[model samples]
Target chain A: MVSTARITRQEAEDFLYEEARLLDERDFFPWLDLFTEDAIYWIPIEEHSDPTRATSILWDDAQLRALRVHQLAHERNFAQSPPSRTVHSVTNVQVSPGDADNEAKVRCNLVVYEVRSGDHRQLGLGDLRALPAKCLYVLRYEERWRIAHKKVVLINRHMPLINLSFLI
Target chain B: MATQQATTQRGYAELVEITDKTFRVSSRVYREQEVFEREIAEIFEKTWVYVGHDSEIAQPGDYKTAQIGRYPIILTRDKDGAVYALLNVCRHRANAICRENYGNSQNFRCPYHAWTYRNSGELIGVPDGGRYPEGFSTRGLSLIRVAKVDSYRGLIFASLSADVPELDEHLSPVKEHVDLWADRSIGGEHKVLHPHRYAYLGNWKFQCENGVDGYHPGIVHESAFSTFGEFGIGNFAARDLVKRGSISRGFPGGHSTLEGGARDGRGVGRGLPHRAEEYQARLREVYGDDRAQEIVSNRHTFIFPNVFLFDELVRIIQPIALEYTEVYSHPFWLHGVPDDFNTRRLYEGTRQLSTTGMVNPSDLEMFAANQTGLHARMEWLVLDRGMQREEVAPNGERMGNYSDEVPQRSLYRHWAQVMARTEAGR
Candidate 1:
């Protein structure tokens, strides 16, 4: 059984920073490898709502993510010709106590500023409350820390949005 | 109305000298505040503007709020299943009654003064009723109803002008096209799956022109087309076949349609390695041999002013300003088809063509460039393509071949007519 108390706040912050680095560096394959096979990436369309009923900007299973990654890598994607550059800032990392032996809840505030094709874009500001975003190597010692779900709730839900090509 | 008259006079005189051969429009049309105000009063206020679909307010007390030009209107379904379009402002102090975008509600209470209205838009409560005079009647104070609220094939539309033509009359030639869109649904009932809405920083007319222009598909979407080709899906060379054929342009009343199939529709679909068989089989099953063949292979048609009903989806254009436009796209399923088929249709339609879709970003880029180009030193942009080929038919439909500028010209013609009428009233 993994102890929620065992993972320090600094360790959680480091994991988030590394994850951000992988994304900013366009190391998509490695970034995708962080999620479990069954893990979901959801960006909800409504604030504090379930993704099933309410529409989402993005709701991708592993296969969809793979296809997106493939498209991003391809040279023919016109929108990505110049490629999108992003800097993700993660802060306010907080760990909540978990009920399961191997699970713990981690929350962080995120602000992603992106620029694509010479145009500056304000991607979004959101809070990610991911459960079981496990410690990378410590999963064997504590099964509870594996990520079960990662939910992103953006500040603007109803407003019109441009492409969400880059990960948030 | 007075301001509408003055603006119309100026617009009519300017449009009179313009003809089917004219390509560049006066920059004044895009920049004049008076013209914009007149359009709100004369066009948007008078005509029946599409609001939302019946499915949006399916249950009793379900409501959605939208804007009709500059006026805020609420669309609500009552207990009796009657849908109404009423002013969103309260009768007492004119404060907005509902702040939420959409919700299920029994009654709306104005936050300013607590004036309460029923789901059907009837004023039900006034705080401290005894304070009012005896003859003061809440009966006359019910939420002011929009002049007309009607639905065509489950698509709801409302108009603020009492004198505007009937809904069916206004739709006229375009009704047939709209029917084609809804005919796919079982029981001939089509509902919006809540639209995929997005905004573009360009004039709304640019969107209207983009959907009808077949010339740009191959050029602007070269990247997407090339990707499809790499996937063994579609070949840009196949589009060359249509280039040899004449562009067929038709105008039915104020509505206009542009029709031209790919050189070989079957060949293009065949080139797409993925889902080709599935799409073909579904088409054959739904349309049955000959009919399905025709349905699957046809050029796109635009119903003037604000709607574009493509073979697979419908895009409704709402103008936010001369420089900003909002588009709402909804996918329609062929009635009686398998649920899996509709799901695939929705998936393909949204992923490929929606605002945030695979092909849309490039299209948006083109629109942005066009918007920027309009600011260039050139007084006008050319629209003279196919001017020599325009032919007037006995039925009043102006016909032109595939590569013609006739469709854009047709829209300007309608614009001129509406603006002229407003001028005459002055």
Candidate 2:
């Protein structure tokens, strides 16, 4: 149903890679810009959850997104202080048609490595948190491709989750 | 194991050092496996520990897994709606029976030997009953229920030992807080959302202490509070008030509460952020203004051993090892509140308390850091904050300012008594 020609897998990969790079570098504001005004970024504790009915690890509308972005940008955000370092390895980018004429659906695998360390030595923490996940993005082309909805499903969603202080 | 335990018991004096006005807990209490085992037997096994909310297993045949101390059990409701807690282990071959988190089933059949049990935990079917010797007897083969199960306003609690104190007696200190909270549930009750489970790479006691710990927020969670300040909604006397106008009470049996004293309905940790005029009006009409206001006041409570109810959150601490703990947080959705209000509660609950919670990461980090620091050969972990000003209320309850160590000392006092308990000198 996409109005434009079928989106190439490489282009879809580019969208995901850029997003990952921004998150890895803690470039949250620009990363947040990739989302459409009403876009949803969700990480369901249970797969295929209804965000309105069920709880999720991360369920952010644009307003909630702005709040989170503001928190991450705030100089006093200690969780981000000394900041968590993350490296996301994305693979198997796949693209399919979206529900709307301007939309593109993309799915990929993500393995994120995170470490919370530095200057906190007084109380003491150089903790490591790592996990793998599947990310599905519902993209819309408004001038350029922007995220309409994104869901990240962790492989170990059932495991007792540690601090997910960094972006997936 | 017994001899090594004897050696550890001898060090119990060194494990905890207490005075009328000061207390110091050794790092070993957080690091020793023997101490952990003793606590399982002396504290958790002997005391009444909270299991699940009654609403969680409301329907017949509804079941979910729960833990007592370290024993895994299944909390199931039978036909005709009798609630029961059965050990998850199977009778035959000692295998686990129920594997799923929760589901509706009148019977659970063990995959190991196909031993099936009715929802009431009766041994209804055997793979081949005739194959057994005549009258071998399946008399005591039903799933073992916890020793005693009681509830305080739908908050189900179970004691593993028959000698444990009555539920009301154990909850005496915080009974008023519990009853007030339970009554405030919009329709006189609330439902539990699926728990968000997480683990802290620290001892379980840290959670019991930290839930009502008023001293650490300004310093440890400064980043989170400051982050909230950037939003303009958080600077309104939250952290400042936490250090003042507040009183914490220590209960018998290692339980305690931190109660903030503002009765103006503007308290930060009390209720939903929305004006909630309709909700409050209904509450005022039902319970009257004085009672409703008292109920709405926030009470951060530790229900001994491992359960905490703070605001709308119910956190159950599961001790897995000396330095590892798994926690399950059940955010209650009030029955009478608007769906939108419940939705926001769920959203912000995740934001504030879940695995990736804003306020919790720093707290968890501090706990882990403390555990890491305990590796050093330190003599004691200082917990003497505000000991001088601790007051004994007229009712004989131990009281202190919000930012005092009185509650922690209260807990350690109970812990000390439990660790030293012996049935009439053995």
Candidate 3:
């Protein structure tokens, strides 16, 4: 059985910062380890969507998440020919108790600034785009905190976007 | 020949060169602002452009907004269930009357002057009407209606010029294929769900060429297929695509298709492994086994100028400029199918085609590269792949190997023909 301990706001904030760091530093392999087996990394088109029924920007299970990471890291994946460099800013962490004793729900505002890393300063590839999002995370503790679900709703989710190949 | 003479007179004849042995398109076709402007004037404005599906505005007052070239259009189902395409601009001050993407409104009141118009584009109420002159009349001031509007199998199309051929003439070559796509639903109706809207930095024609060009999938989407292979998610034998009988076809009016070969009995439906049996069973009950099997075979149908009907979704391409285009991919639900079936197809469609999906981003990346590369001094790009092996079917359609540029050749041929014609029929 998992421990029924209350997760503090600071602890949840710290956990989010580490996850954000892993993504920003492009350490996707280790970032993949932070999720539970059944965890979902979802970026929904609408604020609330039935992932099974409705379309999303992304809805990845453990298997798909791994595939995405592999594809990003692959040499021939020219979409990331000069892989995107991103800086994730996570703020306003508000943690609350979840329905399960081992779970806690945390909400925060996030801004991710992404740009191409190399000399390819083409229009779509070079622009420093900012993705502002309202994010929600459900953290569960077994031995340590693991993400059960992470939902990201971009401020401009409904608008048309460019290549979002990098992790957001 | 007459159209070519007219285009030559206008000094635009050198863009595309065609001979018995070779077919070539100028790089300027992808790089020039003048050529882009002429395309909007000569091709998009004169051809039948897809607007929205009939299912989108099924009820009275239901409406959706769209674009044909540079013109903004509103497609509406009026009180009598008649569908019409009207310019979205207000007749009075040139302000747009309807600003929302979609809604059910019997009347649209212009925000600038509160000039209200009925769903059918009749000027119903002009606020403070007494201030106008006595000779003024609203009769000629209704929103400008598109010259031609028609549909085939619930896919609506509008043309700015009535001088164009009837919609059937444009769609005849691909009507049977369209039947197969629409008949996936037992009732022959499909619902367009919300779309995954995205844009790329490339010429619009690049997308038009890419959709039907089957050759690029092996190289462009190698990463996606490899990832899928690693997970054992689907049987993505990209190498066996040709031996499996996949084929590319080009019709006369620029429409094209990439059809799955017969060797893959499950066809592209392999994407949704769990729902295939039940879905095929339901299809067989409605259509006989042969027809059901044909319907099950994967086909990506590109209907000339704007839209693609493929794999349980409709992808629309909108051109913004010489090197800017927007795409909308809407995964659709078939009528008379189980929710699970629709849901699974939806997931598969969005998984590979959405803005952030593994497959399409690679294509978009290539589009950006192609746009950047077109600036080089190279004069021509080759479209001669499979020219020797391509065959003309009894139906007058051209067929070639799965990796052939037959579809691209057909697109440019038709584009050249359309670009040569004058609106005045000179």
Candidate 4:
């Protein structure tokens, strides 16, 4: 029920920044609304490995995303008992034209600094981890820009990773 | 410092104390640097440690790098299709020969000085050969090979010690459990996908003890069970399996199993329903009804020292240090099952067991917490949950209730026996 206007580079950048803000703020329920109904939030184990054929760090559909939110909210989910305090810094956003005027492919560099806040000083919790990744977002305009797909390719994808119980 | 008594063989044997009523492990076993080093020597280096699966190196010249205790190894298939586990160090110097995790190559040329070795650990080429002394034979210069290499249903294991028992003998205690898992494919092969590797701040045996220790799922994994239950999403550790009668069985070796009392095994038909049905029917055709039913029943089996085979994935525990451990979780794909089914399996497996899975992170948290808590002056950690109710089966397995420390007791018994071995005993 809206115009099929072309999305600009500024609009894509703003959308990505807002998304990053929501994630860093831990406003998960509101952030979930930014995605399309058939959204695919993926963090692939390997950049080139087929998600259908290979294992992924995370491949959350709407149902899974909701389930994860529920899990995080549960009182006994000790993995996130203290909940990570994260600051996501997004930069170098480049919006390229998509197949349609209402769609665009937005690429950006993301660095998230996360620390498990509270009394635990364990290796995974007390330590401040800086996760760097290359993020690609497929945006579609339906009155406003909504993410159809979000892929975060971590730099240390093949290495031994620690507690990634939080949204990255 | 009193626990520093572990410098001797008898001291290692004393780490576990078992009476008719109770079983306890020394806290020093988790907190000591010396105990960890001795374990690498007396246990992992001496036992048949899993290296790689046969499916990973299906073709000739296929190769993968692995580690057994502290030693780096290369697992390769030669042109003749013979598999070998070779030390990855160069013959000339101690430089590593293969750096890549896995690939296919007939020969590996060292980055330093270009010394080369064939896939079967034969010295094929060496640069500047003329500089060597006269009659400096290359016979003994080949990559130092492991003493024994063997596989059971595609799971390869290697031993560094020549005095150890044969791999078959070592694996005999849990072969039936292994067969039930492997035979699920009907072709008797499992294709291991790329691993989801994660590290934790805890002793390696924590992973070993955690895998078969059935009591924790009801307590530690409360959120996961509750969440999955509310959504009706099936997982390996379901609540009903707890309410029903899942049992814990421990073998003579350190191996143990968490046998689900459920008929269809939890999470068996949750995803890819049609494919699951097809897989079941096909398994029944080859193995008959009773065997097929046994195959479908849940069995989370753990082999001694390193590997665990759950319904969804194969978990390899790699000990790094006294308080650090690395785990590799590889989702299993049935050989003849359609790719879609395997994909669903991967998704479900990783969903629960991956680095960021709903279940694994909490376990990691507990392991780290346990490691930190062991710094207390308290000396013993009890492993006596269902000891009174434990019964010995005809097959030699000690069976206990679903939430029992029987498996942990089994692990410690074997651990003490292995650690207590002396040069005279060998």
List the global CA lDDT of all models.
0.66, 0.79, 0.85, 0.85
Interface RMSD of 3: 1.1
Candidate 2's docking class is medium
Better of 1 and 3 by lDDT: 3
Off by over 4 Å in 3: A1-4, B1-13, B263-274, B423-426
| Model 2 lDDT per residue over B210-311, tens place | 988887777766656665666664343456666548777787678888876666554223235554566667779999999888777767888888888866
- Angstrom error of the Cα, residue B409, model 4: value is 0.7
How many clashes would you count in candidate 3? Answer: 1
Q: What is the lDDT of residue A88 in candidate 4?
A: 91
Report how closely model 4 matches the true complex, as a DockQ value: 0.78
Off by over 4 Å in 1: A1-15, A26-40, A46-54, A61-85, A94-107, A115-151, A163-167, B1-10, B13-20, B232-250, B257-288, B297-301, B311-313, B331-335, B399-403
Q: Which digits, one per residue and each the tens of the lDDT, describe model 4 over residues B1-426? A: 555454454467788999998898988888888889889998889889998899888899999898999999999999999999999999888899899998999999999999888899889887888888899877889999999999999999999999988888998999999988898776658888888999998899999988887778867888887888788876545556777778888899889998886767443545788888888888789988888878888778999989998888899999999989999988878878788888888877777889989889999989988998888837889998998999988876898987888788889999988887773455
Native contacts retained, all candidates in order: 0.18, 0.49, 0.77, 0.77
User: By TM-score, how accurate is candidate 3?
Assistant: 0.95
Among incorrect, acceptable, medium and high, the docking class of model 1 is incorrect
Model 2 global lDDT (CA atoms, 0 to 1):
0.79
lDDT for position B302 in model 1: 75
Residues B27-80, model 3: lDDT tens digits: 878887878899998777878998889888989999999899999989999999
Q: What is the TM-score of chain B in candidate 3?
A: 0.95
DockQ of 2: 0.53
Among all candidates shown, the one with the greatest DockQ:
4
Report lDDT (Cα) of residue A155, candidate 2.
Answer: 86
Model 4 spans > 4 angstroms off: A1-5, B1-10, B235-239, B423-426
DockQ winner between 2 and 3, please give it. Answer: 3
Per residue, candidate 4 scores C-alpha lDDT tens digits across A34-134 of 98899899999888778888878899888788778888888899888788889999889887876667677889999999988677565556788999999
